[model samples]
Target: MSQPVVVVENLVKVYQKNIRAVDNISFYVYPGEIFGLIGPNGAGKTTTLRIIATVLQPTQGRVLVYGYDVAKDAAKVRRIISYLPEDAGAYKYLTGLEFLELVAKLYTKDPKKIEEFIEIGIKLSGLGDRLNDKVKTYSKGMLRRLLVAKTLMVKPKVAILDEPTSGLDVVNAVHVRESIKRFAKDVGGTVILSSHNMLEVEYLCDRVAIIHKGRILVVGKPRELMERFEASNLEEVFVKLVWGA
Candidate 1:
C-alpha cells in the first residue's frame, strides 16, 4: 500500500566465523505503520533493523527507504530516518531537559524547529519537573522514557528502534508503547522495531514478522496469525511455529 515506504529483499548478513546472522529474509513496511521483527535474543532482529537504519551493511540483498537504497543512497536514507539502539544511554551529567534540548539543536538549526522538538520531547517523555534532574539520577525506566522521547522528537519519517521497551517495568513499558503509537499516528512516522516481547508485539505492531535464527517464519497481522495458527495469542503462534511440529 502507498508504494511501501521500506523494503528489504533477499537480505543476508554473515560474521567472520561463517555465521549467517541473517539469511535471505524479505519484508515490506508501509507508510505510518508500526511493523515489528519479533524473535528472541540473537535472532538477527537487531541486525535487520541496523541494515534499514543504514548503520550496518548487509552481506547480500538490498534495503530501500522511500525509494532510496540504504547502501547506494545512504545519506538520503539517513536524512529521513532516526535510529535508536537497544543499549542507548543518555548523557548522565546532563539534566533530562538539557539532554533533550541538546538533541533538538543537533537536528536543526532553526530556532523555532528546535523549540518545537524540545516541546514535543517534553510531552512525549512525560517526566514533568523531574526532567530538571540530572539523567544520572533517573531510574532505569525514567532514562528509557527520555531516550524514547529523543528518538521520536527528531521527527524522522522512519524510526528504527531496537527493543524499544526492553528492560522496562510494566508501567514504563506501557508509557513507551503509547509514545511509539503517538509517533506513528500523531506524528505520521513509520516505525520498524525489534523485540522479543510477544505481548508487546501483539499490542504495538500493525503487522509483524516472526523471526528465528535469521529467518522469517511468517508475516501477518497479530490476529490474522493467531486465527491462522488456531492459537489463542501471538505467543502461542510463535511456539507452534518454532517448537511445535
Candidate 2:
C-alpha cells in the first residue's frame, strides 16, 4: 500500500479555552481513496477539515499532507491540496468560464496551462454552454458543480471537501457525488470529505470515521462497521454507536 497522503495525529482544537470543537482524534487518508468524515452538525467535522486544509491551526497535535507538516509547511501543502467549504460561493459577476480561469491563474502563470485547466474544468463541470453565463444566474446545483470542477481541475494530490453535496436536489446531489469519485480515481488523488448524508457516505467512501461530540466513535469500511454492529446499514450503526439506540 502507498503511504498515507494525509495524516492527523491526536488533533485538538479549542475555542474560547472552554469549547473543545475537536477533541484528541486522529486518522489517515491514502491515495486514490475517498475517506468520509460522517457526523451530525456540531460534530467538529468542519473544524477537522479546516485544520487539514491549513485554514486553522490545531490547539494541539499536528496534521501532515504528503509528509509535510501543515503548520510548518503550509505553503507547500496548499500547493498540493484543494479545499471546498460548505456554502462556498462563486463570483456572481464572473462567467463560469471566467471564474475557472481566475482560479487557474492563481495556480499557474503559463497561458497554455491555464487554457488546459479551463478545458478540463469545463469537461468536469458538465455545464456545457452555461459556462459562458454569469455565475449569479446559476442554480445552487450548477454552482456546486462549478465549484467541484474548480477544486479538481488542477489535479491536486489531496482534496478536502466539506459537505460537497449539501443543499442539492437528488439528481444534482448524485451527479456531484459521482463527479468527486471519478475525479479522484482518474487523477489517483486522495479525497477527504465530511457528509451528514449516511447513504451518500456509504456509497462514495472507501472507508469512514463516525464522529460525534468532537470525537471519533469508530473507523472502518462501511460494510465492516455494519456487520460488526449487526446493523443492516450505516445509519443504524451510527445511531447505535452515537446515541446508544
Candidate 3:
C-alpha cells in the first residue's frame, strides 16, 4: 500500500468528568482509500473522529495526517485535510453562495478558484434558485448538499466525514455517498467515514473497523467480516460484535 494518509496510535479521549469517550484505539488509512469506523450511537465514533480532525485534543496517544502529527503539527494537518462533523451547521444567515465563498477564502484565496468552486457546488447541489437564499431556510437535504460542497471545495489530501448522510432521503443519501466516492477517486485522497448506516459502510468502505464502547472489536473487508461471522450483511455482523454471538 502507498503511504498512509491517516494514522491513529492508541488514541484516547476523556471528557470533563473523565468519561473515556474513546479508549486506546489504533488504525491507519492508506492513500485513496475509504475507511469506515462502524458502530452504534455513543460508541465513541464522533469523539475519535473529532480528535483525528484536530477539532478536539486527544487526552492521550496520537493521530497523524500524512506524516504530520495532529497535535504538534495542527497547522499543517489543517491545510491538508477537511472534516465535516455529524452536526455540521452552517451560519444559517449566510446565503449558500456566501457560505461557499467564505469556505473558499479560508483555504484558497484565489477569487477564480472560489468562483469555480461555487459554480460547481451550485450545479452539483442542484439548488437552482435557492443558492441565493440564506441557508437557514434550506431543508435538511439541501443543507447537507451545501456542506458537502463546502468540504469538497478545499480539495484536501484527506476528508473526514461523520455521518455524512445521516438524515437524507434514500435518493439524496445515495447522491451524497456517490459524490464522496467520486471526490476521493478523482483527487486520490483518503476518506475516513463514521456511520451507523451499515449498508452505506459496506458499499463505501474499502475496509471497515467495527467499534463498540470506545474500542475496535474487528477490522477487515466488509465481506470478510461478514463471512467470518457467517452473516449475510454488515448489520448482522454489527449485531454479532455488539451483542456477542
Candidate 4:
C-alpha cells in the first residue's frame, strides 16, 4: 500500500486513575480510502479519534498524520484535517450561512467559497429555505446535512467524522453517506469514520477495523472479513468475532 496518510503505532490512552481506554492498538489508513473504525459504545472509538485529531494526547505510543507527529506537530496536523465529532456543538443563534461563513473564515479570508458552499449545501441538503434561519431551529437531519457541508467546505487532506450519520432518518443517512464518498473522491483525501452502524460500514467504508475493549479485533474489507468468518454480513462477523458465537 502507499504510505499511510494516518498511522498509529502502539497507541494507548488512559483516563483518570490510569484506566486504559485505548490499549496498545495500531492501524494505518491510506489516502483516498474510506476507513471505518467499527465498535460498540465505550469501545474507545471516540477516544482514539480525539487523539488522532490532536484534541487529546496519547499516554503511550505515537500517531502521525501524513508523517507529522500528532504530539510535536499538532498545528500542522490541524491545518490538514477536518474533524467532526459525534456531538459537535453548533452556534444555535447563527444562521446556517453565518455558521459556514465563520468556519470558512477560520481557514481563508475569502468568503466567496463560503457563499458557493452555502448554495451547494442548501441545495444538496434541501435546506435552502432554512439557511437563513438560526441553527437552533434546524431538525436533526437538517443539522446533519449542514455539518456535512461544513466538513466538505474545509477541503482538508483527511476528514475524520465520528458517527456522522448518527441521528438521521434513512433517506438523510443515505444522502450523508453519498456526500461523504463524494467529498473524499473530490480531494483524493482519506476519510476515517467511526460508527456502530454495521450496514453503513458495509456500504460506505472500503475497509473497517473492528474494535472491542479498546483493542482491534480485526481489520479488512467488509466482504473479505465476512467470508473469512463464513458469515453473510458485517454484523454477523462482528457477533462471531467479538462474542465468540
Clashes of each: 0, 0, 0, 0
Q: lDDT tens digits, residues 1-245, model 4?
A: 78999999999999999788999999999999899999889889999999989999999999999999999999999989989999986799999888877887786666686666555555545577688899999988889988987877677889899999997899889989988887777767789999989999999999999999999999899999998999999999999988961
Q: Which parts of model 3 are misplaced by more than 4 Å?
A: none
User: What are the TM-scores, per candidate, against the unseen true structure?
Assistant: 0.97, 0.97, 0.95, 0.95
lDDT of 2 by residue, 1-245 (tens): 77888999899999995999999999989889999999889999999999999999999998999999989999999999999999799999999999999999999999998998898899889999999999999999999999999999888899889999999999889889888988877888899999989999999999999999999889999999999999999999999998861
Q: Rate the local accuracy (lDDT) of all candidates.
A: 0.93, 0.93, 0.88, 0.88
Please write out the lDDT profile of model 1 over residues 143-233, one tens digit for every residue: 9999999999989999999999999999999999999999999989999998889999999999999998899999999999999999999
- Return the lDDT, model 3, position 82: 88
State candidate 1's TM-score. 0.97
Question: C-alpha displacement of 2 in model 1, angstroms?
Answer: 1.6
Screening candidate 1 with a backbone cut-off below 3 angstroms (N, C-alpha, C), the clashing residue pairs are: none
Q: What is the lDDT of residue 118 in candidate 2?
A: 91
When sorted by TM-score, best at the front, the candidate numbers are 2, 1, 3, 4
In order of lDDT, best first, we have: 1, 2, 4, 3
Name the best candidate (by lDDT).
Answer: 1
